[model samples]
Target: MQRKVDPEGLAAAAFLAFLATAGLFYVNIMAAIVDGLVSGLAFTDAQAGQVAAVNTYGAAFGAAVSIFTIARFDWRKTSILCLVILVAIDLLSILSTTPMTMIGIRTLHGLVGGLLIGTGMGVIGRTANPDRSFGMLLFVQFGLGGLGVMFLPRLVPLYGVAPLFLSLALFSLVTLCMMPFLPDYPPRSVAAPIKKAGTVQWTPLVLAISALFLFQAANMGLLAYIFRLGTESGLSRDMTSGALGLATWVALAGPLLVMVLGRRFGRFPLLLAGMLLTLGGNALFHWSQFGEVYLLANCATGITWGLVVPYLFGMTAEFDGTGRTAAAASVISKLGLASGPLVASMMLGGGAGFAELINTALAALVLAMLLMLPPAIMLDRSARRPSELLPQGKVTA
Candidate 1:
């Protein structure tokens, strides 16, 4: 007998996916904003870097808040409120003439964006196949981000950065209409286990969370500077944008690949392979002098990112029964992303070039590789256990 697909679940996942795109718009367009601020507002690189970082900082705080209070409100209504605030802040961002004001406004925007992300994650986490749900989320994020990277640069030359902000606001407003389709809360089976927090395992959970933070910090640290790297490598603006866009689209393949494989080879092997691929990609970026080689490096890194992120989030969900840990992991992940650009900016201070950026990325990748080892070991050990003997969420392949 064929099982019927749940329209509500599919709708909810689509909403969460779009929410992911809207939530990440600022980061995806960071390069353009930096250029705009430096040219339009006459700000220094450090100042522009702060403008980019504050949004993620605010998101970290908002995710923390959501971790504790998410169960108290209706997800649909909460999302609507967050979306409205996001639109308001994105619009207000255009009025800032000073870095301090831009930071202040962006901070507020990040908070709301974080809340939306947490809310969406909460909804998607409750679904039966979180791996696939998160894959959908990444697919939407990269797909839309690719489009933005491809076109936003062209728009920037004509209309400047205000339109980019406005476009994001408009996108959020559109997502608001999808809120009605999302689930109000997780399933009772998933939510009712809140009192068992005392019994939750801490070691693996902590390791997994740490791995996520380090990996993102490493990935975003490099990615935050990819546009700069392209230009420094002698690519024209249009060529750089095209490379970024193409890489993002290529990244979509990672999640789709995960979906097709579906635990066939187990998580540890896939995770390890993804990390190794990331290292190689960074190496390629470091060595490549030609524009085409640099773009290929982008594609390599994109594929690596697509391959790993879902499993990391899935592992977090597996470790915690109540989903608070997953929410906390989101916070940590955002903090890593927020820190990445700041770290890159500091490294690139006063006319440093691609060598500095590549070196920093390599260092970060090494640290991420180290942090991932313990979790991979744990997953490997768990995969050896009999299916009936395994804990509820510990079943790997």
Candidate 2:
């Protein structure tokens, strides 16, 4: 019997996936997170970046661990526990007096968050349309991230970064309330021989994961320093924050376009266009001294960001019906996020300017786009079928 997609189930699942990945929302509002640590906590720029990097590093580790457990664990219970721990960690962050202490606790927070997001990706991969599911994920991230970047900086001076941590705790609390409403998502069952047969798809999976990592690293490396980039270019804090917020809001178009199109037109064309736009956006940062240019650069990049990520995830999900590849891709994504800050911080510390950083990011994006081609081509060719495949645990010959 053919199964129909339940709209209500899709909504529930997308929301749950969002909540699960919400633990890493700090990355979406990277500028504000960096600022909060700097102004509110008095950490140096490099220290702040290091802290952010380690948090994601821990997340990468946790995500790697999740690849093993994603198909075995009860997602609802796991989400509940992770959210609870995340809330506790956020509250504890408020008490952090030193960078070392904050870094340690944040790493722990990242570990738990990574596990949640990895599991979330697994859920997304199981959906009727992984592309739409991932689009929803980006839509929510950009929406709330816009609000956070716009307002969090304003509150920081008045409340001393307390709002930052508190906001995270509040999000967790809200997610906790939404927990009971989530439908049960059991572990994917697979026959052992069928799993073995699926190994032929690993080559494409690896390529897709590589592309995602490079794209994320390139984007995040710039984002982690965008605030600094703006100020150094003589833009006011208010202007920078406003531009970021508005850009994020506008970025919704990217994901919306993805949802509307799905795989109708294929992946590489959109990815290629998006990547070129991203490259141009990064190039525009070379003119960040101009306000209009700064604003335009952010909007361009943010839109492409929203457009590209879902396709990448959807591409990875194509290789394996069991969601394991998607889960592994999540791990790589976190590693890329973790690496970006470290790389940016090093370049800055070694006397490299923002131009150098942006250029490096541009190069990464180009390479990432190139890496995406083979997998995108493979998936596009294979997709000439009645419909997408489900996790039946066996590969057809």
Per-candidate TM-scores read: 0.88, 0.87
lDDT of all the models against the reference? 0.74, 0.81
- Residue 141: error of model 2 in Å? 1.1
Flag regions of model 1 displaced more than 4 Å.
1-6, 9-12, 126-132, 180-187, 190-204, 287-289, 318-324, 386-397
Per-residue alpha-carbon lDDT of candidate 1 for residues 100-203, written as tens digits (9 for 90 to 100): 88888888898889888777776665667765666667767788788877777666667767877887898898888776655544545743423344434578
Worst 10 residues of 2 by lDDT: 388-397
Deviation from native of the Cα of residue 176 in model 2, angstroms: 1.3
Clashes, model 1: 0
The TM-score of candidate 1 is 0.88
Worst 10 residues of 1 by lDDT: 388-397
Pairs of residues clashing in candidate 1:
none
Residues 26-137, model 2: lDDT tens digits: 8877888888888888887788888889989988887787777777787778888999999999999999979899999999999998888777776665654555665567
Predicted model with the maximum TM-score: 1
